[model samples]
Target chain A: EPEVTQTPSHQVTQMGQEVILRCVPISNHLYFYWYRQILGQKVEFLVSFYNNEISEKSEIFDDQFSVERPDGSNFTLKIRSTKLEDSAMYFCASRGGRYNEQFFGPGTRLTVL
Target chain B: TQLLEQSPQFLSIQEGENLTVYCNSSSVFSSLQWYRQEPGEGPVLLVTVVTGGEVKKLKRLTFQFGDARKDSSLHITAAQPGDTGLYLCAEARRGGATNKLIFGTGTLLAVQP
Candidate 1:
């Protein structure tokens, strides 16, 4: 089965540095999203992108965060200035067809020190 | 913002035992989806419940959407050790032509052999 895939499975970065997480959603899927889960906490929505623009974003998706569909096949999330609280597992998801379920990537674990 | 609360943050059960996990929300959702996530991985979609009073089953797992569309449940019959994972429920929050998921608190289950 086709699955969402993310690169750099684990990343360790210092605070105030920039980090970019990459994801390749399933081919032919349109809607895309970025979410984060602090260890042992709920998965929190950061932003959603469609039609080359942001569709929805939560408070967590502040100026420090940005998402881009850099190309037809790659979606990227960039953290301009990482903070200690930014340490978390970031997941990328895509939905297609009826939009009943959103497929997720393996996730990029970001650890900020 | 919609918040989904899950019961029994952690559960450890013996193999072949049956258990139910829950997802509740104060706001209504057009659809609720259940996902299973293993350590170091993103969540995998398990089921989606769209209509009120809807029930859907997949193999040993059964899912139900409450009549009010504000809650859902997952019941596993004779669960095996392979059923161990963190379970999360989510729904797309309506926004300007975009759909983004808001997830539940999550339930971690460990089925012991």
Candidate 2:
């Protein structure tokens, strides 16, 4: 079955550096989303995108965070300047037009030191 | 904000045992989903329940949505060591153009052989 895939399974960056987490959702899925989970914490919604625009975002999705669909298949989340608290597992998900079931990618582990 | 609370944050059981994980919330949900995740991997979709009081079974796993749509439960029968992982319950984004999933804190299960 087709699945969502992410690049750079793991990343390490300095506290003030930038990082970009990339994901390629299922080929035909229309809606895309980004979520994060701190160690021993619940997964929190970051943002959602459709029609190449951000549909909604949570409070945690502040100015430092941005998402882009650079091409048909690639969706990316960029943190301009990482913070120690930004260390977590970032996941990307997508859902097709049919049902509400959203498929998730393997996730990108972001480590900020 | 929607908050989903999962009961029994951690569970350890022997092989061939049965267990149930509960997800509860004060806010009613339009749909709920169950996912399983390994240590370093993204969540894998197990099932989605839409209607209130709906029940769906996947092999040895049984999923039920509460009649009020504010709770759900996942029951695993004859669980094996392979069932060890983090189980998450999520509610779909309500009244929005996007379908972001609001996830619970998650339950970590370790099935010993």
Candidate 3:
């Protein structure tokens, strides 16, 4: 089955540096989302994108976070400045339509030093 | 914000045992989904329940949505060591342009041989 794919399975970056996590959602899926899981914590929603714009975002998705569909296949989350608290497993998901199943990617582990 | 609470954060059982994990919330959802995540991997969707009091079964696992649409449960029968993983319950919020999911804290199950 086709699945969402993410690049840079793991990344280590210095605090205050910028990092972009990339994802390629299922080709036919329209709705895309980003979520994060702190070590031993619940997975938290970050943002959702559809129709080439952000549809929803959580408080955690503050000024530092931005998402884009720079190309037909790539969806990326950019953090302007990384922080220790930003270290987590970031996941990308997509769904084709309302009430359709959302598929998830393997996730990218971000570590801030 | 909608919050989902899962019970018994950790469970360890012998092989062939049965267990149930729950997801509860005060807010109603249009749909609820269950996912399983192994170490170092992202969550994989197990099932999605859309209607109130709906039930669906997959192999040895059964899922039930609450009558009020605010809760759900996952029951695993004759669980094996392969069932060891983090189980998450996520709710699809109602009346939104985007189908963003609110995830529960998750239950870590360890099935030992």
Candidate 4:
């Protein structure tokens, strides 16, 4: 079965540095999303992207966060500055359309020190 | 803000045992989905329930959506070691042009042989 794929399974960055998490959703998917989970916490929604624009975002997705579909196959999440609290497992997901179930990637573990 | 609460956060059971996990929310969802995540991996979609009072069975696992569309349940029968993982319930919010999932805290199940 085709699945969502993410790059840089794990990343370690300085507190003030920027980090870009990349994902390649299923080829035919039209909607993409980014979610994060603090260690031992519930997974939290960050943002949803469709048609090269953001459709929805949570409070956690503040000014520091941005998502881009720079190419037909690549979707990326950029964090302007990392903080200790920003360390978490970030997952990328996609769905074919409005009524389809979202498929998730293996996730990228971001560690800020 | 919509929140999904999962009951019995952690469960440890012997092989061949039966168990059920519950997901409750104050807000109604257009659809509810169940996912399983193993350590160091992203969540894998198990099932999606779109209609109120719908039931879907996947081999030994059975999923049910409440009649009110605000709650759901996952029941596993004769669970084996393979069932050991974190189970999450996610709801797709209503009234959005782009669908995004709000995940529950998750139920961690450890099935030992």
Of 1 and 3, the candidate ranking higher by DockQ: 1
DockQ of each: 0.85, 0.81, 0.75, 0.75
Model 4, span B18-68: residue lDDT tens = 999999999887889999999889999999899999999999999999999
Better of 2 and 3 by lDDT: 2
lDDT of each: 0.91, 0.92, 0.91, 0.92
Task: Tell me the alpha-carbon RMSD of every candidate.
Answer: 1.3, 1.3, 1.5, 1.5
lDDT of 4 at A71: 89
Write down the DockQ of candidate 4. 0.75
Candidates 3 and 4, the one with greater lDDT = 4
TM-score of 1: 0.95
Q: Residue B113 of model 1: what lDDT?
A: 100
TM-score of each: 0.95, 0.96, 0.95, 0.95
- Interface RMSD of every predicted model, in angstroms: 1.0, 1.2, 1.4, 1.5
lDDT of 3 by residue, A1-113 (tens): 88999989999999999999999999999899999999988887899999999999988999999999999999999999999999999999998645687889999999999
Candidate 4 runs further than 4 Å off: none
Q: How do the residues A1-113 of candidate 1 rate in per-residue lDDT, one tens digit apiece?
A: 99999989999999999999999998998889899999988888898888999988988899999999988999999999999999999999998756546899999999999
- 10 residues in a row with least lDDT, candidate 3 chain A: A95-104
Fnat (0 to 1) per candidate: 0.93, 0.89, 0.78, 0.78
By DockQ thresholds, what CAPRI class is model 1? high
- In angstroms, the error of model 2 at B27 is 2.6
